[model samples]
Target: MTRIRLAPDDGKAINLNWRDRFVATDILRDAYVRYEESLNPSAPPFVTLDDGLELGIVHSDVPAIARAISSMLTCSLEDAKNENGGHLPSAVVERVQLEIISPWGVANLWGQTGHRFVLSRSGGGGRSEILATILVGQSRQTIFFLTGRYNNLRHSTVEEEVDFDQPAGDDPDQRWFDLFAFPEIERFKPWGYHHIANFVVAKGHRGERLSRRLLEGIIERYAKDHLDANERPIEHGQHLLCGRGFWQIGDPPWLTRMERLGFYLRWGAESFFIEKPWAPLPAVFDGDRKIGNLEYNRSFGLPERYQGPRPTVASDEHLLERLPEVIALSEDPNAKLQYFQTMFDFC
Candidate 1:
């Protein structure tokens, strides 16, 4: 068995409970086993299989989980589950509690620490769970999750002397949290430009059909609560918004799961781009001139190796075209603002 820590407390201090449950190599090993079995529909609901043993599949997610199971079992999860009956239980969704300790902490630690957790029930006598967190700010939304540890589960930090007293507004971008925002930049703004659209989901949870649900849920929730029936933006203090783009690590070897989640390659920086289903982009800034067009105070850039469509190139155009419509349709103004601002900061 191996040991690894999942969530850390303040980088310096660690939560022993979370560390033991999520990071301990041994516990992770068990969790991994349950994860593998969950992907294999042929495997009984709660039945565990010995390594290399022939097992039938039962029910599982379409492609992503199938791929993961196939890779793990050296057999297709579809084939295994098909051999059984192709029926699996619905994933148990548990909304984990998350608390932002400090105001600046939410911006500074955003993705690094602000996300919450959720778990799924594995087979009998075992637990299969997924931990996910979303960081919304600057009109940018990033969700990070730890599935079974193999696909997406890595956190790195080093102690450094610095100031924690700087007002959060002073550095709304939290330049210090580059790693947290790197994935989005990598996928959406590879050429060093500001990209308002971006998102990423780790491969592990892709198989569970969780990504699409999560993404749609985010968008739908934003639409319903954030936007009004007229699609006008509502006024809220600082808040967060959620969208889709390349928000994960480099191109994942497995994308079938990603594709099923309503993501498609939009060229350049991101391999997966979430289609903005609603008409017009949401109005982000509070004070502005003109009925159409959102304003930005800074110049945006494109990321390196970016020769494709750049966000900065089309940002202004997109703003003009989407602003009025977004304002009319959106119900949550603060979230819309946060999303746009985050994009600026992320870029």
Candidate 2:
């Protein structure tokens, strides 16, 4: 029998030893329900999909829903340890745990600026079993807030003094100008940049390619110019100038998957753990053996060629040629930071 252990907080750990007969999905569903109930008793309803799964967007505007979503994200990361042979670092775990538990941190991370794409299924007794989730920030304000939040998080952790409070006078608009502070940034303002802040799939669903589906949904919805919920034209105007995100080291497979989905290393903005104080480098392990560092804090952008209504998927031949260069830059972070720092400049 293949026995699977769960996190202690998951509520299933007690019976999991004897429940080896249960399928992976069934086990995951029960654990998700228990976690959700503990986090939020009055969780909101979600849209049911044809396959019995539920798909919904948890808006930061709804505090109760946001808190529940935050809790789930933290739990999902915790669950990852089981899949990774229990090699997930404590620092990475603690950072996320702190982020969700921190005041206004959830809001700053997934609040007003963006919403999360959640896939779940009815877990019986009026609870939904979360399967996969991706957090997206749609506005420039989100970019500013995220950049500042990450910078602050890195600084605080590295200094050995962690503070989760939202910094005073940390206005997104002001922070945007403060970070960029360059004439060149103005030229690329027309391209509406969105951010993929964080994403994760449940342990049972790892090989299912749910991540790609989530990305495809975002592309179909926001890739073109569209009206907002208010029915007014979006201020940034059409063409998702670029979808931006950070790539940590050690996940080369993730890099290849993203490249196939139209994402690429934004040429000049390479960040190294040794030199860049802003990039958080958490130690990662493989079972008892210590592998390399986990995350590199490097930035990647969706290319302009894939910005239109229907993006032409990058061919395998192209990925074969480009993957090496992308891998090389990620491996060697000390590579110089270029003048055009933003994704708009590169994409």
Candidate 3:
């Protein structure tokens, strides 16, 4: 029961209202971050995958990441104001940013890839800052790609001079992480990921084996979460970590480059949740098919019935998609935990 403490308190808990991106003022966002931090911040679950791979969750930086993602991947403020009906013109851009970085939207994208949240990397890590849910087994091919890896493992002291960490104020750098740079982190990075939408190394820390260390961190996270009471590693069948552009099937150059990191599957399927990180809304998947939010329920571990059914994320719907999922977790922690740890560990 030894938890991974982020600060004094932090956990792998995901934000239930992750879809609500309309964080208006600094006051509101500050309050929300405080509230989330208060949720027993502890060490996130982590696990070791192999010699140079580790996995762990980002616990306290959820809100920080949310804000940063909005800013980093958003449109101009004036354009956002026009998107919404001139309401809150000053805050219109912020509103649009919120919708753009909806937590559920990001999660959906994670699921679309083989690294779906519910399906992969279960059993631990601060589920809050999940990158991907990787199943463990002996025969599984854990395919991690090296498309984004640096060219060499040479030594360099250049990155040490610049500090990527941010002060306690509203500094944008504070919201970013230095996974490869290894800077003096007075503050942590923007956030963690599950399906790893953006696991980038700051330009300054591009090479010198920093990316390798980052990979080890990811593997360590998985090992921590998937271990048994006996401290034995769980081996899921065919586990594979992938690099970017991996989706570009049949690329000989991509294949040759990725082979250095790990396995290279020529025919593994890849998915793209187009709605994610764009159209913000919770999804209702009935078995393999996606139903409206209304059809989801506790029986299937989703909740469209509790509230009314909603349409698309872009529609005029104020649906709270995290509520049902949160309730289910509370209702059956043991079962869910057990299920996550083993049910699909081999799939």
RMSD per candidate (Å) reads: 20.0, 13.0, 22.7
**Residue 117 in model 1: shift from native, Å?**
7.1
Residue range 1-347, candidate 2, lDDT tens digits: 12232122332111112112122333332222111322223443333444675454544333333344455555555644523554345655555556542223444444544455667666565555566766555443233222234422221132243232333355533322232221122221223345455566655667777766665544443333332332432222122313333222113224555555556533323222232343333444455544443232232232222233332333221222333433454455433212222221111
In angstroms, the error of model 2 at 183 is 15
Candidate 1: worst-modelled 10 consecutive residues by lDDT? 88-97
With candidate 1 superimposed using the best TM-score fit, by how many Å does residue 177's alpha carbon deviate from the native? Answer: 19
lDDT computed for candidate 2: 0.39
Q: Ten residues in a row with the worst lDDT in model 2?
A: 12-21
1-347 in candidate 1: lDDT tens per residue?
23233233322221112211122222323322222322233432222223211111112222222222222221112221212332111110000111221211222233232222112233324433222222322222222332111111222211122222333235545332321111232222222221221132333444554445444433433322334443543221112233232233222222334445443333222211111322233322222322222121111111221334334333321233333333332222211211122222111
Candidate ranking under TM-score, highest first, comes to 2, 1, 3
Per-residue lDDT tens digits of candidate 3, residues 68-95?
A: 2223234223322423322123343354
Q: Which residue pairs clash in candidate 2?
A: 249-296
Q: After superposition on all CA atoms, how large is the RMSD of candidate 1?
A: 20.0
Of the two candidates 2 and 3, the one with more favorable TM-score, higher being better, is: 2
Query: For candidate 3, what's the RMSD?
Result: 22.7
**lDDT to native, each model:** 0.26, 0.39, 0.27
Any runs in candidate 2 off by more than 4 Å, and if so which?
A: 1-49, 61-64, 79-89, 100-104, 144-191, 221-253, 260-262, 275-347
**Top candidate when judged by lDDT against the true structure:** 2
lDDT of 1: 0.26
